[model samples]
Target: MNSCPFQRARSPEQKAERRAQILEAAALFFAEQRFAAISLAAIARQSGVTKAALYRYFPSKEALFLALYLSELDAMVEAPLPQEGPAWAAISELLIARPLFCRLTSILHTVLEHNLDESQAREFKQALLACFAQLAARLQRDFALEGDQAIRFLMQVQQSVIGCWAVSQPAPVVASVIKAPPLDVFQVEFGDALRTQLRALQAAL
Candidate 1:
């Protein structure tokens, strides 16, 4: 008898490996294209999985990207920021180094959260809160902030990243236009603007 060709992940470890492979494929697509431009069929092809198999791992495109974003958040929480004389510099540098994370975060509210079902939404938010709480605790310890202050600081930083990233990444034509002498003033340098905003927020708090 001819052997069946499709491979199935029966063990938990195999399932996790399959999930990671899918996430990796999604990440590559995200790096090269805008969020709105990516599709499940493309991702399925890249990951060597049928669209049906992809749905078994993730209910929707939103759910899959949300899972990837959550993994990024977990990595950020685990990464160490400098606990030196000033916190803003370290934080700014960290964000600058992670452009994909910043981009995903920029769309967290506007896109990724919209199509999610209740269970998916709850799971994402709960994981998000856990990441936030851990990061806030570190901020409080490093910056001598009260609990509320730390939370507020993070909220402000989130807003700053979202706003700054959006402005810095204009449409292709607009991006070219902005590089001209007269329009150069409108161009926003993500790292510089973010550092300035973070420094101001730290000073205010």
Candidate 2:
């Protein structure tokens, strides 16, 4: 096996590049295959680094996975929210354009299904909640929703998004699982139902 690229100290630029490569490889691997089936050795090989080098950057597979997960969260927060439209438009744009939102949900589901340790699981939950809270705050501020109603609405939206993404059915079966009377009878509709629900909330408010 090749050594980890991070095993030796290098210039800041080189180190940054190597870490980015490892993260890129990890993300691709996670997306392409089951997280439980992937091994650190495979990641190291995919990254063109030895196990030791991979370890130097990420001490274990879990650490690497968590790092990737956190990176995804950071990306979501840093991504541009729609600036030129009403709050609802901005929220819709964010839901549709932010790859990290979906990716993070997918990762969280994988971690939960695979039975990660308590600490890891808790961290993932906290990160997910934090993302939701950030979205809720933004909505409240930009849309002028206030008080308990805003909080309740945010919670509902958060749950709706999580339910939409975290469910494991094939695309065709998602509608049955959701079973909302007004939702269209289609599976895996991406942002459609969420947008509709949010629009309803806006209309009510």
Which candidate has the top score in lDDT?
1
- Model 2 Cα shift for residue 99 (angstroms): 4.0
lDDT of 1 by residue, 1-205 (tens): 1123337777999889878888989999999998889999888878877778889999899999999999888888888888786767877888898998999989999999998778878878888888889988987887777898888888899999999999888888999988989989999989999999999988998
How does each model score on lDDT? 0.86, 0.66
Show where candidate 1 strays beyond 4 Å: 1-6
TM-score, prediction 1: 0.93
Please give, for residues 1-205, the per-residue lDDT of candidate 2 as tens digits: 2244435548998788778878888887877776778888888787777778888887667667777867766766566666565655666667667545455555555453254577766876687667656766665666666655666775665555666665433444664656675554544565776677677766666
How high a TM-score does candidate 2 get? Answer: 0.64
Model 1 residue 107 CA deviation (Å) reads 1.1
Model 2 scores worst on lDDT over the 10 consecutive residues at: 1-10
Q: How many clashing residue pairs are found in candidate 1?
A: 0
- Itemize residue pairs with steric clashes in candidate 2: 2-50, 3-50, 4-50, 4-53, 4-54
Clashing pairs in 1: none
